[model samples]
Target: MSHTVTDDRQQQTHTPVALIGLAWTLVGVPLAYGLYNTVKAASALFSG
Candidate 1:
């Protein structure tokens, strides 16, 4: 009887830089705008 051991690494897939940037921009701009508006509105509430 003989036993053999194999060592191997799994392959990794990656997202492209441009695609990642586009995804962040798509999500981040709306999020930033919403946050800015919320802060602006909240300030008015506190000012009263």
Candidate 2:
């Protein structure tokens, strides 16, 4: 008697592009805002 092996597995799932873009946007907005604020504040030192 021999045992049989089977892959009875589902395919890998992935997040949609639109969802990924939205997620990135959600994260990037605050990151960009923080960076902008940092730059603006730093520029003040040299502009004076």
Candidate 3:
């Protein structure tokens, strides 16, 4: 039988799902909030 082997450099390390989610949430929430408020203010400017 033949065997296959892989090297560490060929493999990628795994990051935890919760950590990824937390990082996105930290950045995404404020970004979305600021965009929302900016849109609301700009709408008022054009609607008048």
Which candidate achieves the best TM-score against the true structure?
A: 3
**After best superposition, candidate 1 residue 27: deviation in angstroms?**
1.1
Would you estimate the TM-scores of all the predictions?
0.73, 0.69, 0.74
Q: How good is model 2 by TM-score?
A: 0.69
Task: Estimate, for each residue in 1-48, the C-alpha lDDT of model 2 and write its tens digit.
Answer: 999999999799998999999999999999999999999999998896
Residues 1-48 of candidate 3 have per-residue lDDT tens digits of: 999886657667999999999999999999999999999999999996
Residue-wise C-alpha lDDT for candidate 1, range 1-48, written one tens digit per residue:
999988698888999999999999999999999999999999999997
What do the candidate models score in CA lDDT, each in turn? 0.97, 0.96, 0.95
Top model by lDDT, which number?
1
Off by over 4 Å in 2: 1-10
| Segments of candidate 3 deviating more than 4 angstroms | 1-8
Q: Rank the candidates by TM-score, best first.
A: 3, 1, 2
Per the 3 Å backbone cut-off, how many clashing residue pairs does candidate 1 have? 0
Clashing pairs in 3: none
Candidate 1 vs candidate 3, lDDT winner: 1
lDDT, residue 48, model 2? 66
